[model samples]
Target: MELGTSLEKRKVPNMLKRILQYDVQLTKKFVDLALRTTTLKSLRNHAKLFEVSCHGIVWLACWLSFIWLFNNKELYQLQVNMFIALILDIVVIAVIKAFVRRRRPVPMNKLMELGPDKFSFPSGHTSRAVLVAFILICLNPISIIFYPPLLAWVTAVSISRVLQERHYLLDVVCGAGVGLLEGLFMALIWFSQSASASILSSLSDEKLDGGEYHV
Candidate 1:
């Protein structure tokens, strides 16, 4: 029994190592193919557009700007929740990236200079894309017609990460999974309209008067 248990323990790690090596090689092949197929500068630039659209900083700025401009209660609540979701997404991503510390498939020295951390086990952009899409679909804040386009955006964002050599295939796959879990968590602990409003009001140091804002 002791011998059998020792062998089983040894085999499990070896199996995991083999799987990791295979994943790396496969991701390299896909990245190489993408580079060859998208040799054109314009094509590469277009893929970058998809990447930038789903960047964490861009999402944060856009959501905050929308909240500042729109006062509709429904819109306000949605924006506030989204803002909170983004923060949660950032915290989760940061924690995982720090712990994993995996290198990007392609070394981006310039990009690395822009950010302190260079780990890329899970694609943040892909996670953000999936999270946003899931939230929109679940909430149905916009017309049903928008869901298809939202899904397309998520697909594009995910593919763009691999094509750009910013992340491995497994990184993106796991990122989507993480994003789904985060969305489900957000749904479970979602704030009510009044709660959202009160939180925002407190942050801005504004008072509510007779169930209305007076600032």
Candidate 2:
């Protein structure tokens, strides 16, 4: 009847317990808000389609098109830079999700489909949307008229992740941060070097009169 000294149980440290309790409370607040916010119902209804658009097949098609355009067009650096940045974003998100091992917010039954992805600390779809949007804004390849709409779309995509209950608020926040940093990092290196040089050369040539340096 000794019971082997009750297995010498050790309690979790108070600090860790407090942190966990805080996280649970915060998650609950977010979940409650999402449930009550009726404005997001449209996105919630279409959220599965939005989520699947970020799947690997869509990304592959995009990259393949970029590769073709890069080879045939004059925008080699821009296309290559975007392609590489997207690839990097995918790698970074995948690694972070694996390392963190955070579970998705929605139950398996609520999910649209159960596939390769399960863990969801940082929302990969949100990250990719932010990264792509950031790249286009920085590069300025498209007309200014299109930027606002593109930004709105990106915002909607990020919100849809939460509305669909696939991710918590913090997951999208961290994912956005990671994506923005990646975009800035790529822009600083790629745009500052080759892109800048090409742009400057074009500007200088436009000012040239007879091949001598213009004052």
* Candidate number achieving the greatest TM-score relative to the actual structure: 1
Worst 10 residues of 2 by lDDT: 203-212
- Models, CA RMSD each: 5.9, 9.4
Question: In model 2, where do residues sit more than 4 Å from their true spots?
Answer: 1-24, 69-72, 108-114, 191-215
- Which runs of model 1 end up more than 4 angstroms from their true locations? 1-12, 35-43, 107-116, 205-215
TM-score of 1: 0.81
Clashing pairs in 1: none
Q: C-alpha displacement of 122 in model 1, angstroms?
A: 1.0
Q: List model 2 lDDT by residue over 99-209, tens digit each.
A: 777677654336355456788878888888888888778764677898998888788888888767777777888889988988888866675446633553464453222
Superposed by TM-score, candidate 2 places the C-alpha of residue 179 at a distance from the truth, in angstroms, of: 0.3
Report every candidate's CA lDDT. 0.78, 0.71
Q: Lowest-lDDT window of 10 residues in candidate 1?
A: 107-116
